[model samples]
Target: MGIKKEIEIRCHPLMSWDISNPILSLKSRTKEDLKLLSELSKQNNWEVDFAKELAMSYQTLVLTDLQQTILWVNAGFQTMTGYTADYALGKKPTFLQGEKTSEKVKSRIREKLSKGRRVSETITNYKKNGLAYDCLITIIPLLDSNQVITHYLALEREAA
Candidate 1:
């Protein structure tokens, strides 16, 4: 792997902080930013555009169909996983998994997905170059108006 890829995989932000006071970092929020955040807080999964915009931020976010096929991924995902959208789209997220990825974790994730429940777990995942790293992945089931699962939205951040 190149220096850029190694740096990308290792330099991701870790979720080991005490950020209970998130409002402390809102010192420069524009009116529009506040409005967007308010709107997102009220939205579930029906708002695709809003979700896409939210995913475009620093945290890695990915969307997959109910069948687990990748639909879209944010730029942050590309930076962190070393898989560009062109190569990642239309593939399953498991393409990033390797021998180090625990089968127990995969089974747990599948069980939660089958039950249409949100899953939060720290698991080993590989980058495009096959280098493994720990990620705290939160997968939220997206439901249609009739309460049927339509998709899944995954937010991933580095874990120790």
Candidate 2:
């Protein structure tokens, strides 16, 4: 399949953005306009109810760094682990990896991540209360413009 094509749009004031004058090229915009574009891309429809869609099911986590910091966690994390996002953030993700966690498994992950390769596996994790559960994991490295690895992106689901 071919790659998707992105449509380019020039956002401007209603007065200057005349549909009838399609042939006219718009003047360059200021840095402020670029910032506006960036903000628009990141905006979400806060009016939409996400909890309703989730129906109080499912868990999600965003893991990062070698320390495995819990950069972000959703409501599901609270439902599953009984820990709030406030408590999870800035802490090592391995807090969930308990005594039974295999050092071999952790080392395998370390090797792959150090080379900036993606890895998928099913491993054991613990809840705040010390209850253990299996989790299917996907780890992705977020790279900067220079292609250097920065943060790790981890998607986790209950192991079936």
Candidate 3:
């Protein structure tokens, strides 16, 4: 006589199955990201799910008010900039700039943002530790149902 046994492992949709691995399954990650998007959408009154795909593509996802004050930042922002969300909140993105940053590029970015146009630029940004890194930034204006710009979303990745 022979007996056969099988074991099945089930994991919570919000958690990683591999306890030693920090990275989550794609499905779990998506669920978590959607939850965050839902909260942001509810709080800001904007449909932000459109950015779900972009949330993981960039190293940092920064949300700022129309006045350019930081509202939120994803975990990658802390990994890349050495600054926590608590420290970055309420601060202008310019706080990441340093003496080595380009004035011309800053002027161009300001002009584009003021015109409600999207801006994509590679610029120098300083980390909390005072180290400079080249970052590629893409800023898009977030609009409400009425098409009124209420916030800005910046996707940033460290330039190779």
Q: What is the C-alpha lDDT of each candidate?
A: 0.64, 0.54, 0.71
Model 3 clash count equals 0
Q: Give the alpha carbon lDDT tens digit for every residue of 72-126 in model 3.
A: 6765677789887677877999999999999999999999989988899999999
Q: lDDT tens digits, residues 38-120, model 2?
A: 33223421122222322322245454555666555533455556566667677877778888888888889888987878787
Which candidate leads the pack in lDDT? 3
Query: What's the best-to-worst order under TM-score?
Result: 3, 1, 2
Higher-scoring candidate on TM-score, 1 or 3:
3
Ten consecutive residues with minimal summed lDDT in candidate 2? 1-10
Residue 47 lDDT in candidate 2: 27
With a 3 Å backbone cut-off (N, CA, C), the pairs that clash in candidate 2 are 68-93
What TM-score would candidate 2 get against the native?
Answer: 0.60
Candidate 1 lDDT, tens digit per residue, 81-132? 9888668777899998888999999999999889988898888989888889
